[model samples]
Target: MALRLDRRRLVMGGGLGLAALALPGGAALAKTLLSASGFTHGVASGEPGPDSLLLWSRYVPAGEADETRLDAEIALDPDFRQVAARGVVRTGAYRDWTVKITLDGLEPGQTYWYRFIGPDGSRSQTGRARTLPVGRAERFRIGLFSCSNLPMGWFNAYAHAAARDDVDLWLHVGDYVYEYGIGSYAADDRIAERVVLPAHDHEMVALADYRLRFACYRADPDLQALHAAAPMVCVWDDHESTNDSWEGGAQNHQPATEGDWSTRRAAAVQAYLEWMPISEEPWKSYPIGDLATLYRTESRLIGRTRQADIGAAYREGTEAALTAFRDGVWQDASATMLGSTQEAWLARELRANARTTAWQVVGMGTIMGRTVMPGDALDLLRPDLSEGAVRSFANAARAGRIGLPMWMDRWDGYPAARSRFLKAAQAADADLVMLSGDSHNAWAFSLSEDGRPAGVEFAGQAVTSNGMEKQLGVAPSVAARSFVAANPEMAWAQPSGRGYMMIDITPERVGGEWIFMETVKARTSAVAGAHRMTVEKGRRRFTA
Candidate 1:
């Protein structure tokens, strides 16, 4: 193993060796203190459709094994005076103390207020969410978000979107909650090592730890506000569980130490489903009045195989085991990103949407493109920076690789699946607009099929979590120039900033704006700059 035992254990959130029988920190104490106030973890709604929407909340009780179900009300007024729909959803540890229910029979494009009430009449905060309209929609606003590492900074982007009066939906590209140990993802200086509240200091495995972690992040007002503001559509990237996660395991997960991958993944997924207001499905599509069909895809966890290490594979020498591994593995058409079932389902969704919709929208985890790092850009940045994690990043300016960064574990890795999807898009003749996040930077590209324009993609930057600039300390201008110069398909990119992307659609074009924050150190940072661009209809190219 390139990484030693201690490294593995450390990566897995301390060690099973040190895990005595009971979980660290008193769970009883946490349960006694947890309550529902001001929405407590705040209120959220998601999975908007022409007919229904899903809303979520969490209420920890005063005793062990004591479940709490709140009377959730969806209303036309924020004051709850005019109720449109109401139901009861009970919270349980099986899903980590989170409660979510979908309210159907809602009018399209209409706003609704929702709150959860406990048995004692203690109520959660009232929040608003919207449903997609049917036929001929002129415009819709989405709160674009990615990478919300609590310690990096505040989720001001989420908060910012919520406070605004315009947003109709919130789109989280991925990294909703990082799965790293308290200090592994963020340095102590930025947010102290022991800062993780409810004390999930080690790797989280139990339901309680995951619940506590979500509580810690949701406690942020900005995140709460955003959840309060609009309906959300979410997908997972690697960090939501671990860096470079596959269906079987993760780069950061140590089975011997952190325990089983399935156990950890379930905990993460359960925690996420509980905390966020998204629906039960891993992925789904929403129809916007025949104008666009938004497809929220599931990339992480479900069915991703481990990535091939080409460099190492090439070094396996002449043995048959190595030869078999090296020869057919790279072109293993069997290996996949989305499992066969999902791929088929997606094709059906895309084809079906294309028949009636003007735009087929996809919200995914990674950038969908083939971008080989420019050796020239590498030469410039490597010499200027000291040898550290910054240099480590520069090393990705690889001499020659099979594809892109796999785009920070992107579509490029799953070549066969990508080919199938592109073919599906072409067959459908759909005006495909893909929204992606994961690189922690903004990107707009024209997807091509064998060099012909096939679709368009706009990847949003991070909300508050660090990007290449934060990790590498590369000057904004240098990083921007390096990437733009190297990547011709990249219409516009900001390698140094943290922000969200706005997609405003009409019949003729899809206009995208990168709403960057001045700072994320506080809950209410103002906009420093707004980069506006658009993907014109028929052309399928990003024209800034």
Candidate 2:
């Protein structure tokens, strides 16, 4: 089914509402009009405030061009009838032909359109931007997305969300771009059209390589549309640098082949800052009027301890040995997703905003809810499976029987850290609503401590990455039922889906819907299904 978008119909209810209509054009349509040869990458705005936001664009000067100075315009109308703000900025080859301008003197909670002018008097494509609400707002909508792998499939989810007008702001939790080399993250026989940039076919390790990678991804029309449609808040996950990244190292990084971790990490960070329309702060929180407090946290690379190797724990041989390893070292308190410093900051933020904001939403990278392996996980396997698959399924089941977390990459591996964060939220008496994306699966969790409700989590599926069905070789419905059956805290789940989420917040409640697209293999706005969950104000729990 085609996406049902209402750009002009405003959502009015409780404390929040949906504003209809979004700027049109899917990826294919967008590509036909925008190019990378000149003002190739479309314009974007982000790091929004009540009165200001950053506008960005890339310009390639004409032959033997000496000057890099260009003019930017912000207007009330698409045709620039009402030029609200205008400024000139310079972009040299040093910064890869990209320029950013911070425009001020604008009203809060209002929509504006902007564009850039080249030295040759040519104009960039128009873009839309919105400022954060200052005081009381009727409602706010935030689009959540993650794990957009170009080689996996088309970015249909990004296209679908870009076509919706209800979304006031777009927040990409992480994995904005993959770091895998060619024929790495994707299937060996990947689709020809889905192949990634050949400029740096190998994994991104240096600053120039990372810059090229971002340039390649930014060239995408759907991604460009998402950025052009509204202001965005973003954070990078491990894949942005390398897989399972932490404070010290990463799973995908090999010092011998990749060089120093610190050097590579620095390159990734620099490239991200130069390309994205964001501020320099490692992490920050945003106030959406009195409705919600959105905390965008840096979950990977900053403070996280290295993720646990659950597979190693399972390889301990004897049943008793496996049981011992699973309980003892697996539950280490030192293992953290958020280091002590950030953890304290988060705790204080939760307490400080509890009294004012109706909802405390933490936009993070990984799944915070507990997701264990199914006890009968092996039963779903086919008889012709390889030995390695059987062994993995057996270990998964064994780990579940012993109450060990199946995936160390998520918060489940660091239960103590999660517990501390949840307890801190509970202590603050906060109405917590967690927004997470990384698992590539949709999940609704009712978080609790000591059998008492603590909060709720809305985990969005990947933009195109394969999910549980592909990972575990199970049917979508079967995976959903099994996940719910295995985890009491999980209210619902769709373990095999590729899409994003729409989170609507009001003073009275928080509403969310996981919008599943028909396919990412083909460029289409058709939707296959949607699952919705709601949490009443002050309840700290979602409706079943």
Count of steric clashes across candidates, in order: 5, 10
Put down candidate 1 lDDT per residue, 117-145, tens digits, no spaces: 87677787778888899877888877678
Clashes of 2: 10
Question: Per-model C-alpha lDDT, please?
Answer: 0.71, 0.80
TM-score of each: 0.87, 0.90
Cα deviation of 521 in candidate 2 (Å)?
A: 1.2
Residue 256 local lDDT, model 1: 82
Off by over 4 Å in 2: 1-37, 64-67, 185-189, 199-201, 471-474
